[model samples]
Target: MDALHPHGMPKSAAETEARRLIADWAQQPDQQPVRHFPTAYRDTTPLPAYGTTPPVPQPDHRIVPAWAAGIAVASIGVGAGVTGIGCGAWLVLQGLASVTLTSVLLVTAPFAGLAMVTTAVAGAVGRIRAAVTTHVYEGPVTHHTEITNTSHQQGWFTRTRNDIS
Candidate 1:
C-alpha cells in the first residue's frame, strides 16, 4: 500500500484499475477526419460598368480675384516708395540743420593732416627696425617621420611589428 492510497488498496489492484480506465478511454469512438477539395468555386455574377455616373462638381476656393491681388501689390509698392522718399528728405534736412560743409572741413582738416604725417613716420620706423634685426639658424633640422604597425592574430595568440621611416 502506498501513502497516496489511504484506503489500503494493494499496488496490483491500483494498477489493474488504471489499466481498465485506459482501456475504456481507448474504446471510445474517434472524431471524424476533415476532408479538403482540390478545386475552388467563385461567384458568377457580372460587375457594374465604370464611368457611367456623372462627375461631382467642385466648389470655387479662391477668396480674392487675380486683378484685385495685383492692385493690392501695386498700392503697397507705391506706398513704400513714397515712405522712402519722405524719410530721405527728412534725414537730409536734419543733417543740413545740424552741421555745415565749411564748418566740418575747418574742424577736421588739421587732424587729418596730423594723422597722415604720423602714419608716414611710423611706417618709416618700422621698415628701419625690421632691416636692422635678422634671424639665423646653425643646427641640424630633421623632417617628419611616420610609423606603421602590422598585427597578426590566431585563436588565443596575437603578434605585432612596427616599421618607422
Candidate 2:
C-alpha cells in the first residue's frame, strides 16, 4: 500500500481537495525559503592548502640602547684621559729620580712635554665627540604598518599582447 494514500484515492471531496492543496504548496518556491547571507559568509568553496604553513614574521633584533652607548663613550673618554696623564707623570718622575737635574731637564723634558700634549689632544677630541654624538632613542620603539599585496598567478604558455593604432 502506498503510504501517501493508504486508503486508496480520497473517497471524499474534502480529502481530494486537501491532497491537491498540498501538491500545489510543494510546487511553489515560497514553500522552501532561500537563505540569504552576506557575501563573506556565503562561500562554500574550500581553499587550496600547501603542506607548509606561512612563515612567521621575525622582529628586528639588532638595536643597541642609547644609554649603553652613552656609557661606553664616557668610559672610553675617561680611560684615555687617565692613561695619558698617568704615563706623562710617571715618565717625568722616573727621569727626576735616576738622573742629575741638568740631565733630567735635557733628556726627559721634551719627551714628557710630548706625552702630555698628545694626551691633552686625545682628551679634547674625546670630549668633542661625546658632545657631538647623537643617540638613536631613549627607549624601545613600537612601529605599526599596513600592507596590501596582490599577486596574479599565470599559467605556462600564457602571453600578454598590446595593440597600438
Candidate 3:
C-alpha cells in the first residue's frame, strides 16, 4: 500500500477505513492473512518465501571502553618501570663473584648509560614525530577552497567552470 500520498503519516479516520476492509477480507471463509506475504518461488521473481520462524536479534556493543584500555596501557608502563628498577638494583647488590662496588658500577655504567640514551632517543623521536610537521610550496594553484566542516547538515561542493560552456 502507498503509505503516503498528499497526506502525511496516516490519520485515525483513514486507519479505521483500512481496518474495515481488512475485517471484510477476514470474514471470507477461505481467505486468510497468510496470502498477504508470499510463501513460494515464482517465475518472474522469487517469492519472499516467508518462514514460520523469525530471526533472532542481537545487541550492539561496538564501541571500545576507553577508560579500561587507558588503565591497561598505564599499568603496562608502570610494570616496565618497576622491572627496570628491580633489575638495576639486583645487578648492583649481587655483583658477579667478587666484583667491587666501583668495578660493578663501572661495568654497569656503560650499559646503564646506553639504556638511558636509547630510551631518551626513542621518546624524543616519538615526540618529534608526533609534533605536527607540514610542508608548503609557493606556486600558482587553480582551485582554492577552505571550508570548515561540522555534523549539522549536508556539505557543499564547488568547482571552476570555463566561460565557453
lDDT of each: 0.85, 0.77, 0.76
Q: Model 1 off-target regions past 4 Å?
A: 1-98, 148-165
Q: How displaced is residue 55 in candidate 1, in Å? A: 76
lDDT of 1 by residue, 16-92 (tens): 89899889778875944468879866656565587555444689897998999999999999999999999999998
Candidate 1: residue 136 lDDT (0-100): 95
TM-scores, one per candidate: 0.30, 0.25, 0.24
Better of 1 and 2 by lDDT: 1
Per-residue lDDT tens digits of candidate 3, residues 1-165? 545534674566578878999898878968645547657743565446785544446899887799989999999999999999999988866766567789879889999999999999999999998887768889886764555444433358555433321
| Model 2 accuracy (lDDT, Cα) | 0.77
The parts of candidate 2 lying over 4 Å away from their true place are 1-60, 99-165
TM-score of 2: 0.25
Deviating ranges (above 4 Å) for candidate 3: 1-60, 96-165
Clashing pairs in 2: none
Which ten residues in a row are the worst by lDDT in model 2?
Answer: 156-165
lDDT of 2 at 72: 94
In angstroms, the error of model 1 at 61 is 65
